[model samples]
Target: MNDLLDRLRGILLDTGYTIDGVRERLGAVAAAALSREETVPALRATAGDDPLGLLIRLWWLGAPVPARAAPVGLPVAELAAAGLVAVEDDLVTAAVHLQPWESGGYVVSDRKVRPGDPALRPDHVVGAGGASANLAQLASRRPVGRALDLGTGCGVQVLHLAGRAAEITATDVNPRALELARIGWALSGIEGIDAREGSLFEPVEGERFDLIVSNPPFVISPAGRFTYRESGFSADGFCRDLVRLAPRHLSSGGTCHLLANWLHVRGEDWRDRVGGWLTGTGCDGWVVQRDVQDPAQYVELWLRDAAEQGTPRYRGLYDEWLGWFEAEGVTGVGFGWITLHDSGSLDPVVRVEEYGGQVELPVGEYVDEVLGAVAVAHRMSDAALLASRPVLAAGVLEERIGPPGAEDPARIVLRQTRGLRRSVRVGTVEAALAGVCDGDYPLGPLLDAIAELTGEDPSDLRERAPQALRPLIAEGFFHISTG
Candidate 1:
């Protein structure tokens, strides 16, 4: 079984087809099979309106050939138990399909999302969605004793975490979601996952984990849907509660990775707003505001989602979303990754880094790098304490600006040359550090020299030096001494 899984992973990776791509193609195969079935009307009557589930069943009937050589003698029950398919009320359903044996898992069809039969559950398992994949890849893949996946939609994150953690527990508000997760788990042949039906931590209460990952019901609702996507709770606060609850559920040295949204209030700093969420929790948190949207932008994105769900009146739905934002004093909304590490520090490191410009890397990879960077940053001390101190090249500058229509400058700007395109506001000490950092002496001596030169406190200079060096090291404007 391990050999088969390894071969499958190797083939998939070599073929350049991602797990999501293969799952999507499999869904497409199922959809195409159902569309061509002769007894579609009969199945529709039995299945209600879940086109996705209907397709899954149709694929299972041997009509839609998932692969050319269909692994003859493989039991359908085994596949279901493995989480590849679902059999409900005598209907066959497949969460994913494969067309041919490529180097890796490959699907040659356009995947589809089908709802389930009305009697079964409202929020049926989706094959795999972008949000789930993003959150899964963004999470830390290092070894852990136990991990918890909240709102484990279709069990994608659970399946991924199973490889890294000794044990994994997944939870969702809907029972059907657990069923779907089970199907995905079985089909993928992933192990060590336990699925439960409950909202958030209800199922895992008093059970602490080394890592917690969630996509949650982050889709801000106009009016809540009864199924998987909605929390029946309001925006911002809904995710806030989930995060706040995580600290208690986390073991010492544990980490919680969340994909969340927070409303940006007018005249309020987004960092301070998110920073407030991390206070008194005995956790070090890093929040990145990946993207920001105005009211119209926010409305349009979720409006498309409702329309996809066959909701009527697109304009009305848009209006409702706008009304929700207005009533909540939300001028703008920011979406990003939030990581909380349970380090047991009284004053833990809580930093907010914004990725404002275009990201050349994929979102999942970018988020993964962010987590890796966080882990690396945790191991290192203050920049001044780093043994591998950076030797910056000469083009960095401190530019001061003049007040509008005034002869004197308004403020000092710390600017870097080459790589990362980073800049900062230069305080008096930072400006002094920049001027003196010629890479000859250690930071302590430089601070002493500067204190004597400017009649300032040497302790203050020592404390402020690391702040200036951080951007330099991160931006590659300063290269560290490996020696």
Candidate 2:
């Protein structure tokens, strides 16, 4: 199988069946339509009988083609024997979905489940989607000795980790998912992944990793109808447990990045509820809620995910799910990313917030920078912080907003134009501080100078400045100079 996969990879690259090649062939219009799962535009776009076009029509579009018209290097008979494709009546069709990922590799999973199609298998291996990309972007890019990809469906995360981590372990509860993940790893030319079949941290018991990344089965469902998305545990329990267990499996200074969904109860604060999961973990944690949905909307979304909307049990299942939510006191569900760094501090800095603004792509480096800044902020005393020189982060803009012809501005805002795009309201003192923070002078002296210019007491300014600047430093608005 490994030899066959090696040959297949060569043929795929030689035939120009890569991510860029496919995108150029499909064009923007067809590509956008294909994202919405509409195949007509793509089918029309790939009507040519060329090798690339044939591969696209066969694997990507999931359409049957005449066996004689199969691409020259594609091993139809071997693929059929390997259960990757089916041959019947002089026609060939993909038995699985093979997609060219942006990392210049392929991922194989069960065929896309469209509405009105047959029900999904209980152990269906889902393809890489938005959640997979989110976790990948959130992971730190720093080199590490070993990495763990928990619940690695189709092994997409391992492909991204191959360049940095020396050794990788991919684990999944479903055997089929592990099988497909191995196939994906082999085809991507990635080797030596310790593929294990177990739930959560069981496979790696007593072992630690320098980095861990997971896109777990975090759907808050009443029943575990499908293994790919449903954990079979109670509402949000799986995600919470994963967060609590992750720190123990992480070596000192290691980081864990995960995508999760947590319930928003009617009478409880969602921030406190989710933040409590990191308590006593000895890790600096950051949780960002990107989006939220009410109970009804959440139920409908997952129902459609399995293509169960057209089934006879759809209405009954929907009602049952909503009822379970009501009984469990879930008012809504919040989906987001959870990042934990094992800082081994007695007082770990844990931040939970909602961020719906635009952010820069490929945020792995930014995440590492943020964690380093927060660690510094948490460790430094007021005197140490004031003695340190700090500079404003690049692309930070100061905006003063007021009505026309107004003498004084009503609000002053400092906004980041890069990763996270965070904005904070500020007073005149902080605004002046931001304008002069060039890492040339210590903050204490700078504050004294500002007080001298603003007719305030230097002693008073020094007393209150550290409290105001700590958050800015932690959020990456300011970078403290080591020298």
**Candidate whose TM-score is highest:** 2
Tens digit per residue, CA lDDT, model 2, 143-220: 999999999988999989999999999999999998998888888888899999999899999999999999999998
Q: How many angstroms is residue 191 displaced in model 2 relative to the true structure, after the best TM-score fit? A: 1.1
State the lDDT of candidate 1 residue by residue for 28-100, as single tens digits: 5444554453335333332432333233334432224233222333344655665555666554455454332
Model 2: how far residue 167 lies from native, Å: 0.3
Error of 1 at 239 (Å): 0.6
- Displacement of the residue 88 alpha carbon in candidate 1, Å: 17
- lDDT value, residue 161 of candidate 1: 74
Candidate 2: C-alpha lDDT: 0.91
